[model samples]
Target chain A: MNTLSYGLLSLLSHSPLSGYDLTLRIQPFWPAKHSQIYPLLSQMEKDEQVTFETVAQSDKPDKKVYSITDKGIDSLREWLSEPASAPVLRDELMLKAYCVPLVDPSITRDLFQSRLEYYRNNLQRYEEKIRKIKETSDLDEGEVPAYRDPLFGAYILLNKALMSCRTNIEWCEWVLSAIPQDHT
Target chain B: MNTLSYGLLSLLSHSPLSGYDLTLRIQPFWPAKHSQIYPLLSQMEKDEQVTFETVAQSDKPDKKVYSITDKGIDSLREWLSEPASAPVLRDELMLKAYCVPLVDPSITRDLFQSRLEYYRNNLQRYEEKIRKIKETSDLDEGEVPAYRDPLFGAYILLNKALMSCRTNIEWCEWVLSAIPQDHT
Candidate 1:
């Protein structure tokens, strides 16, 4: 889903928005670096999907507020209507684990153990975030926001995804302990 | 996860086998064609992670069987004991879909719809395969095979994956319906 491009169009459809506003709106799902942002923006302008107007700001430099063109609207509408392909799953770490017999034993062991720790830390962080979010003010976007909180379904997915991560961590531990180890 | 490569090495650790046998065992999770397979095999050989010997056969052409080296075993054992890395996801179709606003509207629509249809067909095929395999007399071997009978946990995952596909399909339809007819 040319996600970034789609995002630009989506935001513009609602209202003309600055790059900063678009960045914030898109961040929850479509992550983008400023580096990726500028190039794609330039590309979209060249393609006539979007045009920018200089907006005077009270502070800081003049901002470029982007609006979607008719062509852009047609494109996103077309995309939104289309079915997505099956997601491609590619985990290079799993592949490397499969080839563990080929590399240095200690290096592999160290790497795996480090990953285990990392996963633990990751789980901790997510737990903290989810807990904080759940405990804090209501998911109701003050009863009437332009967009409904994506969290309704997003949290459900987070549960499943988190469960999967925990399973992966357990699996990692299981494989580590069960496998016979002989340094010599 | 470099899963195929890692699996190939561990599989070799068990005993030397040809690419055909390896592919057959590996496909349930790590499906790879000759193009993807042979190239990686060549690279592993170059790295001395695997050793291969060509053997003559009576009723068939000669076969090249591969085996894991002692160093490979050490590496595998070490890797299993360590923690794994954070998984990174890369979905090309999603990326393309996200950027659809930059492409020609009709072209984007066609591509998106094609992908949707492809996913739907895959869902059907997986469902059928599950049913047929259940009706069959015997189950095969490997990690996924162990869960073949009477809707195992692995089967549950396949089902879950299927559900996700169906959900995505609905999302696509919703997106389609939301768009104006002129875009169509």
Candidate 2:
């Protein structure tokens, strides 16, 4: 099965949600486009992994809300137990760092400074989200029960991301200093 | 221009090399399949960004050694000055971390421990290569030159990779501790 399918199932396991809702909810974990999510939802429905019901509404168009099936939950649990594959870090800045000696030192300094800004902003955003999640009770946020709450899982993810940004900034500063000033 | 194309030019800027040789040289930065490299070489030659000359050898079949054109060098420098794009970190482990509360904690703990091992091995391998690179001078291993050397760029890349792997193993250990023992 596709990884995205499991992500959708995992989201539905929390609560029944529309395709649009799924698109927004999954962004923090997996930033997939809506175009990708809608088609996958239909495919999962055909495969009997997920089922959708059209909920009538007076103000908006009828929405097809999706929920995970028993098969989907079983599949998710199986996947969760299996080893997680390593990600290919197609990092462009790291790629640039590989070519920095060919360029002006000032260019690299600027790039590092910009990245420091970018990751600082990213780190701040994740920390704010983590704080918000913690402030709300499990019931208020529609979380899985405290025993099975996915927020705990999300917390671990956010914590790692926060740490990664911190590491990046530190490395960038190191690179800047390592390059000779007279070289520029 | 394709990122891979610039990577090829950057490699050629160091010295003229055959397609297979280029594949080996570029592996430390961007690992490309031989299939991908050969076709891109042909395409780049047609674009006037690269040119090749066939050299016959007494012991072996003729080999086409590729060198970057002036146009290619200009293109590479232009690209070097441009802002780097953010890579999509499609990290599956982080994705798994987002759902860990749904599975047995022992499974995640085991996965994290295994990952710690994997990255620790990776860090050691890169560190060894870095040490080897530092100890050797020209003729010891054919280096470009002290002036136009790519080793400086490569050193930065290796340092970052080493730090990244270290960070990953540390994070894995932290995750193992963060998960409550009773969760299993």
Candidate 3:
């Protein structure tokens, strides 16, 4: 099964949304191109996991807004309950690091420095996002915090990303220093 | 160009080896399936990057030991010098974390716990490997450590994996604690 299907299902379970809306929601973290999204939505519709209704527009093309069906929710819940597989890491930096001893030491140092800069920038961005999530998740006056609230999961996900950025930055720094000044 | 081609070139630069030997060398870190390797070797041979000679065996099928050409070495070096791309992360755990709020909190908690155990086990394995690398890299008397020695790169790679495991375990622990004790 397409994993993007599950991501869309989670989004649609919140509310009926057009393909554009789904793309926008996922772009903040897990980006799916419109080309990918539209096709997947079509497949899901054929599979009866989702259904769409065309809504007319005054000055634009009609939009097909999609919502998750009962089947979609059941599928999403089941997958979420199962154990996740080991991540397939396609990390280019790690690959480069593996081969760096064969190249110039100066080049490897530059690569580590470049990666450190990237991760540090990401750290700042995720930290800001976590702050925003905390503010958004706070209950307003007369609002009830339910145990089943899905926003809690969203909160944890952002925190995990934030932690990941921090980890990457620290790892980059350590690798940079550990490389000998006259490394082969 | 096939990414596996570069990995093979890096391996063969150390010494001439058969396909089986190459697979064994990479299995500890950068694993390439035999199905994938044999074909890529054929292609690399056609590209004039690697050459092979058949060796007869009495007790088994004849082996084709392969060696990298100067062209292959140049190609590997060129690619390593270029800037590495941002990693394409396909982390299933992150996906599950994103949807956990839709499932039972107990399930989410269990996911975090399972992930913690995996990282912890990985941490121990990498730690031992790091120790072994240090021992191996230590030169005996009259041995020269070349600046271009690939062992240096291999050492760094192990360190990077060790750091990654540490980062993952720490992230899992933080997420576990941040989750409310009574989450639904």
Candidate 4:
């Protein structure tokens, strides 16, 4: 199985989640579309890595909720033992940033301004999530969850997201400041 | 044309480059394989967005050095005016991080330790490049290049890379600290 398949199994290891819930939960870590995820989930079930139950919903159509099997946990342990592949980041803004000399200074300013807003919004969301996690968990101020705790993984991941988001926001503001206020 | 197509054009706007050079230069911003890049260059040439000339080398086989056409510049300008699509970051380590509690603490420590090494290597490379840029460009200490300068884009992009790398390194160290020293 590919990294995404292993990623799906990783999420299921925490708790059984519907495919929709899995889709939402996996976004910040690994962005995969529904089309890609559904087929992978089906293949995983066939391989006995994961098993799903048809959960009936009153207002919506039935959904498949998947849980990791023993086989899945074994696969995850194997995958974890291997070195993870390098991160791949494809940002259209970076490409644009490379050619900023071709555009107006105002256009350049707008590009970074909007990106600043994007990061700010994400910062707010991540902060809210981390605060919620703190409220729910027994974590003390400046204290991390124990390695075996269920919240340990989520705690660290949220911290990474927050750190990265704030870094991007800072970079965007720096870029904006560098741009001239008016086209000369 | 896809975003990669525009990305290639964006790079060409700075200077003409061979497909091999393009593949190498784009790696820091958009990681693409030689197989993927050569085919895209051919397609871009067919669409008249770029033109190429065979440059013979004494030690190596002749290569096609591509230069952006007026059409390519127009395309890049159009792309720059539009808001960039959201960045896509697919990091396998993050997936593994989300399931860290499943593995031994030692295993988790190894994962972060290796990632820390990776970021350190990158940090060194970026630091060296930024140093070279500073030495070559007319930029003063803590001064940014003008928007119209050829080095402006590279300058900002490198700063972003450095900032992001340092942040990641900080994160890995923090995670490693959080993990217990001895398995309980």
Candidate 5:
């Protein structure tokens, strides 16, 4: 399963946060929907992993200020201690890669060229996001936020993911060139 | 869905094949069980993608000899021409990479180390398969059997994935050293 729940815990471990804070800040990394959110929040509450107090806002939507319980802290701590699983490489690209050179070398070459462009676009996005963050935020080296910042981990994740996209593009280009260029 | 069906077309594009030959020769790259085999075979026949006729065996099990239809070739051609889907990278290792700095630093370090080892193992498996192919067949580079030949593309994919893993390990090690290096 997609580990949004774990993402929720990671958020709360930084500090008590509202559902709104989670939706804006953490959602960028984990990418959850309200459907996954409300249910997970209720389940976490039922499990006594978190407690939320209803907060009213004068100008905008009211919010639930959710705080990690002692149990939640322990859970996050345990999760942090446990070993991570192996990479689950479910690459549809691999399917395409296999089909090509056999079906029509011309088509395969064109497909790979397009994919290279896609990666280049992604790399641009990652670089832009990094630049924007650097200009806007006061992040120190490795960004050790003062005992209450989910953004720290998010920043690290973004950097790593960006590197991955760069590496992917580089690899894809190398592979594209290595295969004999066949237009037909 | 797992696109093992492509392997069948790839094989048949080269020549007619029996069901047993499919199970034996084609199953290794894109794996399937007996349960999945007959159903997909039947579906292909109804779709007029493949023609199957029973062939009696003198001493072995009777087999359905399957040949690609003209329509099948056209379908395969169209499939090759269509834009391939973007790679669906369900990388649990990447999530784990996010988890690493959040998780115990030492455990995270150990995990990457193990991952590095696993990648090497996979590379060895690929190498071993390639060697076995060479030993068993007199097939030259251009004359290689379609499904049986080593896909240089697959090698590049594996190579890229491994390089990413190695780079990740290096990054993890650097970060781990920079950190307090006290936690396990």
Candidate 6:
């Protein structure tokens, strides 16, 4: 199975979740569309890696809630033992940044300004998330969940996200400061 | 045309390059295979966004060195004016990080250890690159290249890479410290 398939199983290992819930939860880590996820979930069900139950909603149509099976856990363990592939980052901004000399100074300023705002928004979201996790999980100030705790993974991942967001913000601000102001 | 198409043009805007050179140069910002790049280069050529000349090599086979056309510069300028799309990051380590509890403590330790090494290696490479840029560009300590300078893009991009690498290295070390040592 592909990495995304295993990623789905990884989320299910925490707790059973509907496809919609899985889609939302996986966004910060691995971004997958509903179109890609639904087909993979079906294939995973056939492979016995995951099983789903049809839950009927009163106001909405029925949905498939999936959970990881023993086979899935075994697979995840095996996958974890192997070396993870290198990360792939495709950012349109980097491409644009390379050609910034072709555009006006005002345009360059606007580009970095908007990106800085985006990272600021993300930083706030991550901070709020970590605070909520601490409140709900009863983690004390500067305390981390135990390695075996289900919240441990989420905790570290959120910290990573926060760190990355802050770094991006710093970079964008640096770029903006470096840009020459237009006198016209 | 796709974002990758624009990305190829962005690199070519600086100077003429072969498909092989483009593939190598784009790796830090956007990872693409030669197979994916070759066909796109041909398509870009067909669309008149780029032109190429046959460059004969002493020992190696002749290669097509591509240069961005006026059409390509117009495309890149238009693209820079618009807001860039959100970055897409698909990291397998992140997926594995979420399910760390399923594996043994030793396995988790190895996972982060290897990833830490990967980031450290990248950090060194980026440091060396920035040093060379400074040496060749004749910039003083803490002096950044001018916005109109060709080295400007590479300088800022390297700084971003250095920042990101250091952040990842920090995160990996933190994760490693959080892991409990196995005492059998």
Candidates 1 and 5 compared by DockQ, better number: 5
**Per-residue C-alpha lDDT of model 5 across residues B21-88, encoded as one tens digit per residue:** 77675543455566777788888889898998888889998878999988877776677777766654
Task: Identify the runs in model 6 with alpha carbons over 4 angstroms from their true place.
Answer: none
Candidate 2 residues lying further than 4 Å off, grouped into runs, are: A25-29, A54-63, A137-148, A180-183, B24-31, B54-63, B137-149, B180-183
Q: What is the Cα-based lDDT of residue B22 in candidate 3?
A: 88
Total backbone collisions, model 6: 0
* Candidate order (DockQ): 4, 6, 3, 2, 5, 1
**Which 10-residue window in model 4 chain A sums to the lowest lDDT?**
A136-145
Q: List the residue pairs that clash in candidate 4.
A: none
lDDT tens per residue, model 2, B80-132: 89887765566667767766777777887777887888898898999898777
TM-score of 4: 0.98
Residue-wise C-alpha lDDT for candidate 5, range A1-184, written one tens digit per residue: 1366767766777677887677675543555567778788888989998999998999988988888888876776676566555554434455556546555455666777888888898788878877667666776656533212344454555676677777888877776666565543
Worst 10 residues of 2 chain A by lDDT: A138-147
The candidate 1 chain B region of ten consecutive residues with least summed lDDT is B142-151
**Which regions of candidate 1 deviate over 4 angstroms?**
A1-38, A51-70, A92-117, A120-160, A166-184, B1-7, B20-33, B55-63, B74-83, B91-184
Per residue, candidate 6 scores C-alpha lDDT tens digits across A28-121 of 8899998999989999999999999999999998999999999999999999999998999989999889989888989989889998998999
Supply candidate 6's per-residue lDDT for B41: 98
Model 3 Cα lDDT, one tens digit per residue, B69-146: 989888988988887777656566776666666776788788889989988988898878766766787756423334
- Estimate the lDDT of model 3: 0.76
- Candidate 3 chain B lowest-lDDT run of ten: B139-148
* TM-score for chain A, prediction 5: 0.71
Grade the docking of candidate 5.
acceptable
lDDT by residue (tens digit), candidate 6, B63-100: 99999999999999999999988889999999999989
TM-score to true structure, per model: 0.52, 0.84, 0.83, 0.98, 0.68, 0.97
- Comparing 3 and 4 on TM-score, the stronger one: 4
Task: Give a tens-digit lDDT track for model 4, residues B63-102.
Answer: 9999999999999999999998899999999999999898
